[model samples]
Target chain A: MTALLSLAIDITLLSVILAMLLCMIRLLLGPTAQDRVLALDTLWMCAMLLALALGLRFASIIYFEAAMLIALTGFVSTVALTKFLMRGEVIE
Target chain B: MTPELDTLPVWVSLPVTLLLLLGSAIVLIGALGLVKLPHFFQRIHGPAITITLGTGAILVASMIYFSALQSRLVIHEVLITAFIMLTAPVVAMLIMRTAVYRDLRARERGKTPPAVKDGEASEVYPFSTKKSLSAKK
Candidate 1:
């Protein structure tokens, strides 16, 4: 990677972290479940992006796999939470 | 432990840098909307930008960076993109439906909504605090 690209990745990482902090604020301050759920969804999206950005920064392939794992697990958890929100139960 | 990062020509690095910056900025804007928007219905639309455009841009950047750096096709980013594209809408839709249903039920309960302050609406969330509820009754 070039110097410019490295610097850009750093800035990108900063912005993603800032975004995560914003999501955390919403998650902690939620007065409703949906808001918190919405915040959590956005939070994981930021996490996945963080992983991808990290992969680029370090020139490693492992972070891509980590991003994939975050996406998969985040999706499952969000679905379960949404199901509970909809009907007060995930299994029923 | 950092991998040995060799040089990429300007042609490759420049666009990757732009895409990365663009993706992050968009993600930041989306998160801001989530926090700034007053209502849940309005706020829910915010992350759509992050999930789709922001993710797409970064993944494309990643694809280009990796391919150019390795001198071959490295396209695993595609799988993540596909999974996110397939799942984002479902999650958004289900969450929206739950919100609409919950709001309706709250309306039907015929009790005045708990007073909202600082843009927080008091809806019955599974994770809601109960001490306040007992006092309200």
Candidate 2:
């Protein structure tokens, strides 16, 4: 039973990590600014998913808290980018 | 523990695991689309797919598994889900604005957006403004 559970956890973790790696490729190869920003957005979602997986694997709430923080930071960055794009600057 | 997982039945873990895997796969495919999509406009939609469906799946899995394990109603997963739903669109909006800005500037300069906005001011993303045109010049 323990072995099966571990396998499940490992597979989940591997798949999430693989997704993160693919997003990283877009981050590196993006031919345009929008593409890179889009990739960054995906990257944040991937990281959050990873955190949830960790929480499940360890049976800890701390990972979830960390995930929340990551989500917040990602939000702020995206907003800043949008504002900068619209106004020609992110801040005054 | 969120004060809820203690009573979660063991049976819930299997399906939750499956959902998470499925979500991760979707995210992977979205990234691939981001890489392979031809233009900035098409690329914008790719990650949106991940942010919506992909994140939704993982969040559902979290809610289910945690609720089952902790033996209580865990509602905090909703918070993250809400956060992602709110932010992904905003980020995409910014990227689109940047693309549009580049397009307009390109038309002005008599060159394709690729040549004019490649590292120019008009291409500045709506977020940092600091990383845009002035730096390139």
List candidate 2 stretches off by more than 4 Å. A1-5, B1-10, B115-137
The Cα local distance difference test for each model comes to 0.86, 0.72
In candidate 1, list every pair of residues with a backbone clash: none
* lDDT of candidate 2 over A1-92, digit per residue (tens): 33444466667678778878888988887766666667787788778888988887787778889999989988888677667655778788
Every candidate's CA RMSD: 6.5, 7.1
- Per-prediction share of native contacts kept: 0.78, 0.54
For model 2, residues B15-59, the per-residue Cα lDDT tens digits are 776776677677777877877766676676777878898888878
| Segments of candidate 1 deviating more than 4 angstroms | B1-6, B112-137
For candidate 2, the TM-score is 0.79
- lDDT by residue for model 1 over B53-99, one digit each (tens)? 99999999999989987899999999999999999999999888887
Give TM per candidate.
0.87, 0.79
**Clash count, one per candidate:** 0, 19
TM-score for candidate 1: 0.87
